[model samples]
Target: MALTVDKLMNDERFSGDNVLQFLLYLPFGILLLVVRLLLALVLWVASIILPNKSGVRQMLSTLACWTFGVYVKLKGTRDPRCSVMVANYVSCLDSLAASHVLGTISLRKWKVPPFFASTLGIRNAAQFVRKQHFAECPSKPVLLQPEGGPTNGKGLLKFTDWPCPLGNRVQPVAISVERMFTNVTVHGGDSRSSFPWADALWFLCTPVTVYSLRLLPPVERHDDDDAAMANNLSAAIAEALQIERTEFKWEELRPRGRAPPSRRAGGAGDVTTLARQVKEVLPAVPIHDILRDLAKTRSVDVTITNFLEGVTPYTPEDTTEPRPSTSKPRYVTPAPTGVFPKSAKERQLSFQERKAQMIAEAKKRYIEKNGLNLALNNC
Candidate 1:
């Protein structure tokens, strides 16, 4: 889907002259930068003097959203009384996108590196750092990005080991960057490297567009007990964002090979009692008939080894048919951190060798078990 109207605006027919149009955008770009910087400075000052005040911040954020030709559509409820909010990261525009939805103050990490320092939006966010005197504000709802950086829609970053001192209930807000307006003139990669101030005026006036925010239901944790609440809240946020838990794919998280003896037959005897009930209710059917029916009806693999306690040899010829060929697994290499490796040889290495070896190994295991691949080829 075309996320923004700029796709239509960029067509040559919209702008009269191809060569002169580029020149026209040059001045407008500078104007956008100036406006954004000035507004950011003003907000920073306001945050210091009147720390709890959010009216001006909300107004500016709303204006920024409007300047970008973005409209926020808030779903679900946001309690006016709530103090904490958390969300998924998409782009720098996420803060502006969530402005009207909750009118909450967005939280950023303690330090934003110098490379990303030029962003007026990010600069405006610096006041909320925990060390600052302004951080004590009681009225403002703290907005947090658990992932800590933009993902560019490739996939979600894991949230299992978040390092924040969370409150009772976290409002999980999901911001989808439906589209972006790319200024081809600024060829730099990533938001941090690019001069956000350079094209600010053009973005402000030219209507650089984005879409809305979808707020999921608020998640609450009652107990202060660490073990019970930690995984529960993590799982809740993952479910709300439609993030898969298996994405972690670590050894500890994977299902165990077999039930323990206690679970299987003795101690609690839950499994034994269930087995007895099943034996009483279900008729004794031959294993071959069940296997054949499953092979014909289901896409999953359920051989004799999958069910029976004792090993029985079932050769290829013994089976009625061959299994369908599955596609190769795809391993997506994470984007380069933009730092060069120590040597030229490192630069020459393929992504599989440089960063994706572990991911490839995991993909191989997944493919072996499920007859599916999740790897993507390099562009």
Candidate 2:
């Protein structure tokens, strides 16, 4: 199968592409959306009040899933001993559906309301922690989607090596979603990553999305290498889902709008060419300064961001020799002789004034270093 961005991403909108269809669905979708939000609020409150994994909590969660138009059908036996679950990511709510059925906590890094996190079975944990941590805790099996991001459910993205930290024996849970009237489950456009809450909103707006979850038997690590093990796990899940595994990575899904023209073309290109591009954006910035940052960042947007954010320190270019970027801000060494402020507020104000002065001085120095003043004089 051809592996284009469109093939991997569901580029379709929730409302059909046709103007008439979108207009017809708009009013009803909005009304249905409001009702679903209310139900979600109730579920959130219930999750907080009820005990963890209790019958009431589980029942409310199941009912919430049904109410939100997420119907799940479970198949195959889950290994009771496997604490870590490797699953294919289809939607942002894949974790929620897995939590409801398999009682697994999806590992996440973002901050969510404590109650919501618990209700959704989301935990913020280190990615490289030992498997013993997961193995001892059977109540909360950690689910790792090695693909790192969502796909259009047609193919599996290359599995990352992140799951290797979580033991050898992993229960592979395959989640496949079927949307009524629309094939699109996850919308793709310019978003760098999938937002769970945003995707959940679509779940409520849609007529119904059926999730067919097949829990395969636990896969043990026969291979010694981590990469080999990850590949083996990917192969197992891909075979179960009946989808071809591709070399396409999750990063490929991200829009390259932020990337430099050269980077967008495919390669980083020559360093001098990249530096000149940054120079075009910031003429006052010296060539050496731009080159120094380009070597580190290797992206036009990031290098420019660093300069704008004052993260990169400027070194005066003189004597035809390049100076390394110093961690010490140039303003720190040359302290102005003045009486120290006694009050906390006064001290803060004084600091701000000094910072402003520093910025002004840096700008003046930059102009002088690049001979911009000479150009202005000539003009």
Best TM-score among the predictions, by candidate number? 2
- Shift in Å, residue 44, candidate 2: 2.7
Superposed on all Cα atoms, model 2 deviates from the true structure by an RMSD in Å of 12.4
| TM-score, cand. 2 | 0.62
What candidate 2 gets wrong by more than 4 Å, as runs, is 14-27, 126-136, 183-196, 255-379
In angstroms, the error of model 2 at 280 is: 36
The TM-scores of all predictions, comma-separated, are 0.42, 0.62
Leading candidate by lDDT? 2
Kindly list the per-residue Cα lDDT of model 1 for residues 1-379, writing each as its tens digit. 3222122112121223344665666587667656766765664454455433456556555554554555667767776545667776555556656655565655432234432222223333323333242346555576666553444333444453332334556666666544333531221222322333433334444535554466666666675453344455445555666644323211111113434323544433433343343333222534444444333212111122122322223322233367755874355456668887787777767543755677666757767798765443431
Clashing residue pairs, backbone N/CA/C < 3 A, model 2:
none
